[model samples]
Structures are given as C-alpha cells and as structure tokens.
Target chain A: MRMNLKGQKKIINIETSQYPNWKICLINELKNLNSNNVEIDCNDIDLSCTDILELISIADQYNCKIISFCSRSIKTIVSSQSLGYKSQFIIKKPSDNTLKMNEKNITFSKSHFHQGTLRSGEYLDSPGDLLILGDVNPGAKVSAEGNIIIWGRLLGIAHAGSKGNSQARISALHLRPVQLRIAKKVARGPKEKPQLGIAEQARIDSDEIIISPLDAT
Target chain B: MATDTRVILICSGKGGVGKTTLTANLGISLARQGLSTAVLDADFGLRNLDLLLGLENRIVYTAQEVLEEECRLDQALVKHKKESNLSLLPAGNPRMLDWLKPDDMKRIVDMLKEQFDYVLIDCPAGVEDGFKNAMAASQEAIVVTNPEVSAVRDADRVIGLLNTNAIKPVQLVLNRVRPRMMANQEMLSIADVTDILALPLLGLVLEDEQVIVSTNRGEPLTLNSVNSPAAKCYLNIAKRLQGEDIPLINPAEESSGFGAKFRRLMQTKIF
Candidate 1:
C-alpha cells in the first residue's frame, strides 16, 4: 500500500544583524543546505539595498528558489521583488519596526496600486490584487494572485489568481488584451472584433473563465 | 553645445524596415540644408548605411579602428563627396561586437554630438544588446515601420522599449506605404498604425521603385535629381526635424499601384 507522504522544506530564520555584513553568513548557510527550496524568515532583518542584492545573489548561487518569505516590513517585500525575486513575501505585521514575508494561511490583504502606463517588456507581479490607473500596452504583463483591475485599457497580457484561485477576476475599462489568464485556464484575445463594452470583467464561471460586460444594474 | 546636441536613434525592431535607408537619406537631406550631420551605423555586424550614401569605398577607418585606438575620431569619418557637411561613421564588423559596451557606445555618440549638429545612430534590428548600445546616448528616437501588420507590431514593441528607457519625443515614420492597398482595404492606413502605436507621426514615405534604384547606385534618392518621389518625402522629414513647418506629404495617390495608373490611362483614352 502506498502512503501519502509530505516532503520537508528548509526554513532560514534570519535576523542578520547578529553578524557584520550578514549576507556572508546567509550565503554560507544557504550553501550548506542541501535543499533547493528555501523559506526565508526575515524577522527583524534590515533589508537594505545591499542586503536584498546579496540575498538574491546567494539564492541564485545555490540554485535555490524562494518558496516563501516571513517578513513584517512591507518595504522588504517590495525590495525582494525589486531585486528580481518573484516569490511572494508575506507580511507578518510589523516586527521590530521592520516588515517581513509567508504562506497558505495568510494572503496579507493582497492588493497593489500602480499609476502610469505599463510599456511593452515591462512586467508587474503582485501577491494579491493589482490596480493600474493607466493602459497596459502590448508586450507588457501584469500578474497577481487575486483580481486585477485596470482603470484604462488592457492591451497586454494579464494573469489573475496566478497562485491558482479559480474565482480570480480581471476587469478593465477597455479590455483588448493580447492574452488573459485566470487560474489554470488560458485564453487568447479573440481574432475577430472585440466585444464593445464600457467595462468588462473576466471571472471563472463553472470550470471556465468567462469574459462578459459588467452589469450596469 | 548648440541647444544641447540632438542624438537621435533611427531604430526598427524588425529588419528590412528601411532604417538604414532613412538614416542615409535623412542625414544627406539635413546636410543639404547646411546643417552638419553625421550618420553613425550602430548595427555592428550588419551595416549598409555607407552603401546607401555612396560612401562605402571611401571608408578608410571604422568605429572598430577608432575604438582600438588605431585612428583618431576624425580619421574614421567618411565625408560625403557631394555633401561635405555630411559624414558617415561606419560600424565595426560583427566580430568586434563582443567588445562594444553600452558605455563605449554612449561615449562615442557623445563625442560625435560635440562636433555635429545632428548625430543619427542607425540601430540594428531587434531589441538586443546592439539596440541598447545604439540607444545609450540618444535623446530622441524615430521608429520606422512598414504599413504591414507584422512590421507595425514590431515597431510597437520598439516604441515601448523607448518609452521605458526614457527616450523622449519618440516620433514614428511610416515607410513603404502602398496607398493602393489601403484603398482596397487590404493594408493598414497611417491612421490605423498611429492609433495602435499612439505616437506622433513625423513623416511618411511612399513605396517607390526609385528607392531601389538610388540604393543600388550608391546615391541617396534625396540627393538625386530625378524627381524621385521618395526624395521629396525625405526632404520634408528633414525640414520637419529642423523645426521647419513643412506640411506632411499626403502619400495617398502616390501609393496607387499599377492598376490605378492603367485605369487612369484607360479613362483618358491614352492607353
């Protein structure tokens, strides 16, 4: 009889201030670990520019992909992303005046607001929801774990419920995306004329994501 | 120093979009108006700007030689025979591309801008490191695209890159436009291209066979005296670039294919 067993994950609880230039210690520790999946606990760790850079470099060195982050500082979460790590860092509230990173238990009020046009080749990824005030031009991308709302037209690619919430929806003032994704379902923009609408919303209905005009009533 | 030199990059995301052709003719046109213009080919391995301007055989030194300190900056400049004010900065062979850094490109462009009124960098096709090098010192950009949907799509991608890189005042130049096809509703109109790219139209070039003739002769159509249709288009583009109020040429009837001309002849009973 085969039994269902769970694989173990390595968690690094770092409060890097204990050592000078804590990145060296972090890299050393990461190098010693055999697992490629790492859960970084950045509790009370001051994630300065260099610190985040080092973290990303060390993570890359070990071919380690961040599974999750435990952080209280919101800036650290943003820093992690800015440093080119797409791993969602969960905010465990503020600890020692520093925001941190996390997991399946918490989504951390996942919502991001951005202003201005997202040009082609530019990518924006959020842990929760994403709201863009300007157009998402072609070749650009916006991905979020929750719903994505674009105040302007959506000409680029957008992925909602990227972390696999089938109910995630994508809404826009003018929807004509190159591609759209909701959870596991993928849909290409129609080859025919786009459905004219003032506003449109795409949500998972039954097993498939459906795009329809928002009800005025 | 004169009003902060303009280093404009002529880029097309897709190849064969007439980037080299535009660079050569526009540089000559600007020179004809008594403005010192230098066209630099930054396409690295693949380059043809010199051939277009009839200055290929006159290349004594290239950018590679300059970078290697084998020649001075002025030594690599190939002066146009007809237009002494215009010059060509030939690109290095593809082998030297590995040594060309972004900062190196910017430094060379800055140096060229100091001596010329208009420094036009002809970028390589595709948005690769070569493209980045060409864009390093450019303050303005002209995205060239054909009227075809595929070319328009690629041009849109280049425009996005320019915007993200903070290249201000990006202007679009619609090239090889066959208005006959537009009349048949088979090709995208200037309006359609601009609407999708959302950029200011700088100029339009009618698809003319003379363009090929001038290119093969190693002479810019703008410099030719054959009443070349594409020549007028390039001259107007140059005037617009120099802040002249030259009206944009209406390329509608000029783009009419052979059938329209034959039909006109039949209507006039001259066929």
Candidate 2:
C-alpha cells in the first residue's frame, strides 16, 4: 500500500497472482493498511457488482472505506461504475509479444471472444480486439481498443479503437449497423440494404468512417 | 399426481405482447387434454390471468395468503368453472410487491408443483424485480413476442437474460402474427424474428378478432371457440408443449389457401 500526498488515504493493489483467492488476499491487505480511507487498484481482475458490494462490506468490517476503484478489466470498471463508485479504466498496453510482432508489420493483441447474441441494452467492451460469433441486435453496443470482427450480423452500434487508435477496423458478415465509430470518426449506417451473402468492413479513411465490402487483406 | 411437474414461465419483456393470454390459453388447452394444469399470476401489480380464465369473482385467497399461511394452497387456487382440470392462482394485492422476494415465489411454485402436472407462471412485463421473481422458479420458459421490431427487440433482451440465468430449452412463441402483413413485407417475418432471438419456434398465434372478444368476455378463445384461427393456434401450441410432433402452420400458405378463406368466412358467420 502506498500513501498519496493529499489526505492520509492509501492505495492498495489487489493482484490476481499474489494469492489463490483474490478476495482473501484483499481482506488480508486491508487489515494491514494504516489508513481508514483506501483506494483499491484491482489489476487485471474482473469483479461483478455483487462481488464489489461484498468487498465493500468486508472493508467496512475493518473500518475502512473504499474511496475509489481502479481496474484494468473493463468488466470490473463497468461494474464498479454501475454501483456508483469512482472507478478508473486503465488501458491495457500491448504485450511484449505484440510489440515484437510489430517488427514484422503484424500487430496483434489478445482478442475477447463472445459466443451469443448481444441483445438490446447489452453493452460489451474489450480492452483489445473483440470477436463475436452471433448477431449484435439493435440498441446493443460493442466497443474495442483494437479491431472488432463479427461472424454474424451487426445491427447495433460498434466502436473500434475506443482508446483512439484509428488503425482499428470493424467487420461483420452483414455490416448493417445503426452506427459505426472508428477512433474519433463516426458515421451513420447505410440506409439501403447491403447485398446478401457479402461480408462488409468499416474503417477510418481520410478522417471519415467508411463502410465497404471486406477486401482480401 | 404431481409427478415431474413442469414449471414454465411465460414471459415477454414488452407489455401487451400476450404473455398472460398464452398462459391462460395454454392452461385451458392442457386441461382439455386431461392433464391437470395450474397457472399462477406472477404479475401482482396488474394481475389478470383470473379474468382471462373467467375466475376473477371466484378468487378469495391468493398466493400471498398461501405464503403467509393464512390459507391452504387449494384455498388460494381458483379452479376454472368450465375446465375443471385447469386452475388459476391469483397473486396478492400490489402491496405484496414490496415484500415478495424470489424465494417467496419459489416457495409458492413448489407448493403448486405438489398437486399439478404443469405449473405455468404468467410473468409480468419488463425485466425488473417482478419478472426476476417470476423467472426464479421456472425450469424452462416460453418467450412470447409479436411481429414488431420493438417487441422482438425486448424479447431478445429477455432471452439474453434467461440464457445468463441458465434457463434451458427456452422456446419462442410468435404471437399476433399478421400473415397478410408478413406476406406484404410490411411486418417482421418469422425468419426475421427467429434470426434475431435465435430460439426454437414452439408455436405461432395468428392475429384474430376473436381473441379480443374472448378476452373481453373473461373467457379464453380455446374454451368455447376452438374453431377460431387464434384458438386453433393456441391449442397447437399446447399440444407442442406436451411433446407432440405437430408441424408448424405455414402462414404464407395459410393466408393464400381457398380453404382458409372459406373457414374464415364461416368463423365470422357461424361463431
């Protein structure tokens, strides 16, 4: 735990590799803290809303208040935010292997894979690339720091390069999304129906988002 | 006689999509086939399954009393007047909504399971606490949706929630299907809906005026108007629920056939 210059608040890092049980490790760490107000840095660990609530209650037993939360996991950040917590989304940097692969002009990152249809009001976020095997229904959204590849239709909103990497692209078997966003650019989906059986891809070209048939890359 | 009672939740996230209608009709159709069915109205705020089954005036004790131990399970269960095999369990007053937990719902369903072969829960609209409470006790679900974009979208959201909750074998029932509109490409086709929701099509209910009439009369169409197109559809859905191998009616062929026209003419005149 590190003390900030502001108040007597402490910052605690809950690493997944530190203990077999993250919750137990966190509790043990909280017990050793000298400060009552604490900020938790949940590095690369996913915590649901209930899990966050349980953690807060556990801290309460030790007379410690969780002032804020920071996580590298988008799920954890989203859950914490939904629970009215001040959370920070630490953007995951490209791994060493990805940087090494960049020398060969092949930039790659670990892709998140989802298998079911994302229905309305559902939102999916991936720190790296995002791959979905089902359709993204209208009113739903999927965003990624890297590229997004959908094996099914894209009827919802999709944002690639969410962290401002404009090189990212979004492709789908049927690319008729409600809206498409690439880095800083945004564009409404085409009104006319796309030809059947043709896969499409959307990307930024000349500072504007453009949709076209998936070309052989 | 409650051997392997199937607790099915009939739900549609959007309101006015025929979740209660399907539950009432399915309960009656199942009862007519000699299987004892009990439909529990989980929509405590707007409970109307009793009215649809014409058991509104007969309800004295509700599931609330049963849970509170003020009355026996049979006392709360209002058996249908015409169909002795079917029964309706009305929910308590709206005040019960504040205190009724998912555990309470499961307890009520467990009690119903002991005496009936089928326990169909008429789920409330929206995926709020009420819907969650109703969904808690259900082993499987029948997601009802109309042939409209908004209804299908809501149904999709509900299906996604159901899948996350590990509710298996969740089937789909396309309600209020306008065959003519579907053929004219003015309405969402069966394929358009199924392609999005991605659930097994259990049955389809064609839009018919008799449904409104039957509903207003506090009598479901399957009770006395089995000849009505919508009633036949409800009966077919009931049969399909019992694992009968009945092929789904093709709406395109149904709307175009001369025999269907004659049947429609006769239904309007004779009934």
Highest TM-score scorer = 2
Tens-digit per-residue lDDT, A70-174, candidate 2: 988999999999999999999877777546656555334456899988988899999889999999999899999999999999999999999999999999999
DockQ of all candidates, in order? 0.22, 0.52
Kindly list the per-residue Cα lDDT of model 2 for residues B56-98, writing each as its tens digit: 8888888888888999999988889999999889767766567
Q: In angstroms, how far off is B13's CA in candidate 2? A: 0.5
lDDT per residue as tens, model 1, B1-271:
5456789999989999899999999998999899898999998677788888888788888877887889999999999999998989976765666777888888788778788999999999999888988888899999999988778878878887898799989998999877678777788888888867888888999777778878999988888655555778888899999888877766566546785576445634631
- TM-score of every candidate's chain A: 0.49, 0.51
lDDT score at residue A188, model 1, on the 0-100 scale: 87
Worst 10 residues of 2 chain A by lDDT: A101-110
**TM-score of each model, paired residue for residue:** 0.73, 0.77
CA lDDT scores, all candidates in order: 0.81, 0.90
For model 1 chain A, give the 10-residue run with minimal summed lDDT. A96-105
lDDT of 1 at B2: 48
